[model samples]
Target: MTHVPSAAPFDPQTATIAIVTFNRSNLLTRLLTSIGEMDPKPGRIVIIDNASTDDTAEVVESFRDAVAPADIVYRRMETNTGGSGGFSEGMRVAYELGSEWIWLMDDDVEVLPDGLAKMGKWAPRFKSIQGRRYDYDGSAFYWQYRVAEPLGIPIPFAPAEFDASGYKAMNSGCFEGMFIHRDIVQQIGLPDPRFFIYWDDQMYGWLASRKTSSVIVDEFVLRRTREIKQWDMGIRHMNASSNAYRYYIMRNRAYIKKYYRELGVYRPVPFALGTTLTFGKELIRLVFVERTVRGTSNLFRGLRDGRKIARDASWQPMPPLEAATTTGR
Candidate 1:
């Protein structure tokens, strides 16, 4: 059944969604199901598959008729570009398609039926609007909040600060339900695919916010169906147990530092100190808490790599997406 559009202030047809997936066709199917159930469906859907060795293509093919008027653009990458690169290409395609707004999320999340309509109502006022996220257990997935200047850690907003139409000033962004305008993309450029994963969205959102009005609209909700116990203490504690996660969390700081250096939005001294503290805190977690010897070693290796990355004299900002997909890396 085609769900009729509600009396929302903004038109639903102006927004598009970009979902990046890797080896999770089931979850992607679930997300598509959620989109199909929306009362006011999005104008378009863009799926960026990171070369998954599964039935992802078939899963997307099955949705062609279900979304009705909403165009589905599926791109199966030649290689695995990781989440950052995948989203980079995905948003690039969405930009070219000419949607006024772009909603980004991972395969693990499913939108509440009213989520887009709720956000669409508020979209007329803000340039970038992020929606609230709920966990699989239906608890508020509380990671959404502001970032402290220079340091860029996710600090919690006070209980009283949360309101349906109001929003706190944001210094970072989460891709779970991030809604950004096309103009912001034009000014800030697509997210750096080189990030490859962790902190990519945060940096992307920060750049957009720096250029335009960005806020978290409390009315809309995205259900984050995956559960994790690794992150806590406001974004400072990255209790990463996996070597890959630890490496990216540590190595990516170099890119972040370089970004700030180029942007010159925040002071350099505090940014430098804060970035070092990020590695130091991770070292303690790996060494003292988890007591993983190899994890700590990888942290150190990431730190070494990050320093080299920071010192790269020829580094460029927002390199072409094609270069990121192929040899420019």
Candidate 2:
């Protein structure tokens, strides 16, 4: 059973903008500029740097005064922890700071002038929420998905437009623009860093949905600045992926399987079939749309590695928040 926290007033001052950035110092500067433009800026901004080889630290130092009034706490990791690990650390830092709300985003997007204010309007209603965004081409960025029960996978769902309620139910979470409450974080703990890159947000959001009605509000809060080749799928857009992403997409299925197993929804045959179907779909996209066989071998390699990981007896999930003292970040 999920415990619904008592309704309390939402304060913008209680929000902490948590960002995970890598080598994209240019993009990070843009995002910081946007945050500086907010009418009432966030109380604090915690940046988790994934040990970028670039001048990311110097760039952040340049923005100390740009986002003034809002305290900026930047921690550079000893090594590149990827997006998953960075987000986990960022959320942990924000949660320990006693932030009532943590707004998680990657450095690639720029929050709108009124982004935090718009998202705050629904904070009292939805504890776990997501905001809409636009692509570099000005098209709506797709971020809608529902969790498939029993199989415990995300199924992309798109609606023509949001109705009068101003939001839609969602289980698929994109760390790119997830606005979540501390109570939800207290329940789900942190995202599993083992994922490394892909599907981490989906699993985290699905876990959050188990505790409350996770939603993506109709408000447009972000605009993506990074441009990548994309295939229009009508209802959704398929962004071209890199070799690293291709490998992780397939290999991360093992972690997904572990999640289903923990929830007692794992069925060997169905899950295997689902994974096969996923592989086949990606394979087709790589051959036809991507028009190259550069990463073909990576797909199979990832699948083989995923099976090995699934069979490993030592692998375990991150413990829930209740098991921790909340003193460590």
Candidate 3:
């Protein structure tokens, strides 16, 4: 792990901001422009383009001559590897470039200038605080990291210790706008490429929690732009809700279950029961609720494939998806 320089330095070594972008050229440009305004500027900035066919490359190039303190490196992939692949590539590049800390931001998120500064302030404290554990009380648990209020959402602090019988960690949430120590990645490997999209961040964060505790920094605020659109289902080259998403969620959960089992951190009976219930819900939705023919077919296929992998103890490697050049029209 590289040593990160203090926020205040005489000859400052800057933190690196690594962003993963696809065909969202406009959003990417906005994020980059916002990053350029950060007060204590990052030392380096890296953008991994997931084979975007749009004007993404040109948009990035426009910022090359900007007077920002950070050195910009834009990389283009030959194929689109989805969010998981793009994030992995970007983080690897940032680490190899000797960044002390890596700030992972989604292309569609708009981060304010003070966001990193606030994160840096809270980071050391977050690492030092103890985690909250819970036991199953035979009641449903609604564990959430951020608490919503009439005024706004307040970040929840983890207690030093709590009951630990029949309980598991709640969702670790999304990785976007996350500030990570480089060593955490070194200790735990990169995001699982098997998870092409959904739950990749959750899996990575869960593994990291085993190495060192993580906290949701309340001060660092990021706004995510929600744009409704459909995606190509790979083979057909037709726009639809991605079948690949369903496949990943189903398959990778099994992979995660097995991985934890091997580590002696997971118990099979409860996990199996929980997983079955979860997948069964999806099955019910596919059969009774889902109106789209393609979506229903994909859901059934995902469930069948997922069960097959679990039964045979053999998981196939994911194939890269073709990159779409058009930012949803």
Model 3 spans with C-alpha error above 4 angstroms: 1-13, 127-173, 228-242, 280-294, 307-329
- TM-score for all models, in order of appearance: 0.87, 0.94, 0.71
Ordered from best to worst TM-score, the candidate numbers read 2, 1, 3
Winner by TM-score: 2
Model 1 stretches with alpha carbons more than 4 Å out: 1-9, 156-165, 230-241, 266-268, 283-294, 319-329
**Cα-based lDDT for every prediction:** 0.77, 0.86, 0.58
Instruction: Give every collision pair in model 3.
Output: none
lDDT of 3 by residue, 85-199 (tens): 8888887777777665677777876666666665666444342111221112221112243312111111234332335331223325455755666666676656666566866
Model 1 C-alpha lDDT versus the unseen true structure: 0.77
Candidate 1 per-residue C-alpha lDDT over 62-94 given as tens digits, one digit per residue, 9 for 90 to 100: 998888678899999999998899988888988
Q: Which one wins by TM-score: 1 or 3?
A: 1
- The weakest ten consecutive residues by lDDT in model 2 span 320-329
Ranking by lDDT: 2, 1, 3
lDDT of 3 at 115: 62
User: Model 3 shows how many backbone clashes?
Assistant: 0
